[model samples]
Every structure is written in structure tokens, then in C-alpha cells.
Target: MMKVPKGKTVLVKGVASIKGECEVLGARLNFFECEKFVPVFCIEDCEIEINGEFRILDGSTIPESWKKLAKMDWETVFLYGGVDSGKSTLAAYLANKVGGAYVLDLDIGQADIANPGAMGYGFAKDVVSLSKVSMINGFFVGSITPQGREAKCLQGVARLWKELRRLDGRKIVDTTGWVKGRGAKEYKLAKLEIIEPDLIASFEGKPFDWKTFEVEKGYVIRRDKIDRAKARFESYQKFLRGARILELERDRINLKPDLFRGKDVTQFIESVLGV
Candidate 1:
């Protein structure tokens, strides 16, 4: 793998890395070409500025265009996996790092995050995990199109996702099962739900659409779900896998705290024009 340069756009095939003076214009190759590749990664529409301003495209925490994500009032990161795929464990890891975030165990069917006996204080934030009984006849009207079922689940999910989206602090939402059949289908729906969220992730071996996720978002979807979930006794005992939990712990620690920490008491007091 060659390192890609900063200004010029070049395309390479196979397992090659780009380094120095270029952007990835395009390339064809085996392996998952589009798995985590986004349209922005395609440099076809770009032109080098005179005086050759350099831009680092590979593995950027926040892309130049997406730096505004840093300004969001709340950064939402969602997690999904099969039953016992360690969704909660990973959630705790993120919550702990964020210094008082909220966690929504949206696994209404099987609420593991709602463990009543003893909760892990390693999580740094205030946590709220809910368990709602399934309403009779609540499934999507037709088992037909993913969109139709999506429409049904959307309202059900929106009820929580919206409220979850709005809290004053950082957020981590652990989504329900890949209860659906297809990985591609599950991936599509998850992406739609977290339109503005800073990160959307799932565990490994869970049939998530990593291909589409990357195409939609520029950065690679991290997969630490397996190890994180395995650390928890829950998912490991079940012999389950293929969830798509993101965050490498490195990124979790490296994230800008100011973006996640919410407004200070003084800032709030100032908002009211107080002395």
C-alpha cells in the first residue's frame, strides 16, 4: 500500500496505498472496493488548486468538509448487534470515555443494557436504558419491501431516536437486533436513521452493510465490537458474532472533548444574560 499524496488525484488498483502529492481519482479492483468508500473519496470531480494546497485524505478523524460535525450540540453514535453481541459493553466503553453521556438500549425485545442487578460504573456518563413491551400487531404492515417495514419501524424507532437525538450531552444508542433477514437491508435502515449522527456502528459477524455504510460516510467503519462484546460475559457465551460496533478506542480517546462535553454552567448562565 502506497501513501497517497496531498494535492494530485491518482487511482490505483488492488491492495495499494497512496502516498504523496495526489488524490484517489478512481480505481478498479477485487476485494471490497466500495465497502467503506464514499463518493467524496472519488477525486474525479476535483482540480488541484494553484500553489498546491495539500489535503490529507486517508484516515482523517474529521474530513476537511466534515469539520462542521465538530460544532454539533450533541454527537450521536449508534450501536447494533445480534443478541449478546456485546452492544452494551461497547456502549459502556464509549460512555465512559465521553465523560457522562447517555446510552439507549433500544433492544426493546431483549434489554441487556437494562441490567438491573449491577451496572458497570466504568461508563463515564449518566445512562438510561429502556425496555418496552412489544405492541400487538406493531410489526410493519407488510413483510414486503424493506422500505415499508422501514416506514413502520421508523415511527417506532423515531419515538426514541428523536428524543435520544436531542439530549444536552453526548449520546450512544445501542440498536436492536439484525432481527431482519438481510445484512444489506439492516445496513440501509441503520444509515437512514442516523442521518446526522457523528458515528453509526455495529459489531462484527452480524450482517451489517459495511459496503453501503462506507460509501455513505467517508471514513472506514471501525469494528471493535467483537473484542468488546467478548469481554462482556453476555455475547461471548452465546457463540454469536457479525455485529458492527465501531470506534477503535483510539478514536474514542482522541475525539475533541469540547465537541462532546456540552456547554459549561457559566455558558448556560451567560445565555440567560446573567452576571
Candidate 2:
């Protein structure tokens, strides 16, 4: 255990524990494995026991704008940013600050509240990470990225929002980093139309025509494609850890886009294959 002086800031990556008056983004730090380095500010003199790696920074990494954003009374706040832009970190900070806020994670590729290929929302009374929070509900988008599944992604968003609207308290929405080109622009616009959030907090400058609160991308660790794929694999393993198989009639279950919507094509397939 190491004693941290009051007003000192430390960036910890990997396994660590903190005891005494210390806060990570306005929330108390406990035993946690830092996937990326998270800034821990010593409110008072504290002891931190670390196993992985740490860096004593010059000052706190938390931005003034983030503190200001947290204090606002917006009912619904939408987060816009690219990958590694600290969107999830900001979401967790805001959730901790707002108290009892609901986080709607639409970044299906790197989902925090649900498995890959799906979106989910959870009630965050206090959270160091959204991935640890229990999912209140989820909508399957059937794909990790929103490239070709843009329509399905939007559908999932709308469906999840329908359920989210019924719940009281502030809402924080985190979206994918697919915000470029005309297609991405159109997709985001369609999403905005459905969500209509009171505030749009952007980390990637002001890309939207609508007014947005620009936020600093503080202390982010960029992950490569291999890292992302590995993360997704882990998510899949965790989600399907308790495996079970159940047989149900075809009519009892619903399939999106209904593959059998058209007429019988068994004969055509047989003819083509010469079977």
C-alpha cells in the first residue's frame, strides 16, 4: 500500500485497490481491474495498493467542462464521439454525478451494458464501469458494427427508447463511433429524431448542425482491431457462460426480417444444386 498525498492525482491501469478518501471521476474507488488507466484523485490523504501499473500525474485529469456538464439539469443527455474518445468514461462519471441515471448504450460493437451485437440500458445508482451494471433490458441488433445493419440498429434504438421513456430519472445515451460520411450522418440524424435528447454532449468537436456541448477527451487508451475482437470474444463467452438449449415450435418464436416471408424455394435450391 502506498500513501497518496491530498490533492495528488494518480493514473492506475490494471488491478488496484484504494482505501480512505479517494475518488475516481467523483466516485469512490474500491477493488477494480482497470482495463485502461483511470485517474484517481486523492480528496484527502489515501492509501492505494496497486498490482499492475500506475503514473503520478501533475494534476487531475477531469476537465472543468465535464464538471459543468454534470451539474446541468438535462433530463436526457446524448453522448457523441469516436472510438477511444472517452464516451463511456464520461458516461460513468455523469452517471455517478447525476445519481440514479439510466445509461442507454447504443455502441453495439463495444457494448458496456450488453453483449456485442446488442444494445442495452441499466440504472446506474453508482458505477465504476457500465459493463458491471446489470442490464435492465436489451435489444438485439444481430451485428456488431452498424455498417450494413444501420436500419436494424435504429430499430433497436427506437424499441429500447420506448421502454426507457416509461422510467423516471435522468438518461444518458452512449452511441457508436460511426459518425462520418453521408450514410453515417443520415443514420445519426434518424437516431436523433427518435431519441430527441435534451442535451448532446460531443467529444469529437461539433460535428452536428444542432447545438452540442463540446467535451474534452481525457486520458483515453486506444484499442486496436485485435484488442476489440478479443474484447468482443470475452463478452460473448461471459454472456453465454451458462449454456442451455430449448426446443420450441417455429410459430412460437419470432425472427427479425422473417426469413420465411416469401414462398417455398426448396425446389429452386434442389434444381440449382442438381440434388
Instruction: Name the candidate that leads on lDDT.
Output: 2
lDDT of 1 by residue, 1-275 (tens): 32333433332222233222222212121121221122113223333222212333443322332233223344776554554554544454345435556665544333443322111111233222122111111222222223334433344444455555555777666655554567545444554444345555544433443321111122333346564343344522332355566756675575555665654644543333323
lDDT of each: 0.38, 0.84
lDDT at 120, model 1: 13
Off-target runs (Cα >4 Å) in candidate 2 are 33-36, 245-257, 260-275
Candidates in order, TM-scores: namely: 0.35, 0.87
Query: Model 2, range 1-275, lDDT digits (tens) per residue?
Result: 99889888888877878887877867876767756677888888889999888989766788888999999879999999888898888998999887668999999999989999999999986666778779999999889899887766776887899899889899999999988789888777778878888889998787778768999888776899999999899889989999999889999898789677743445533332345
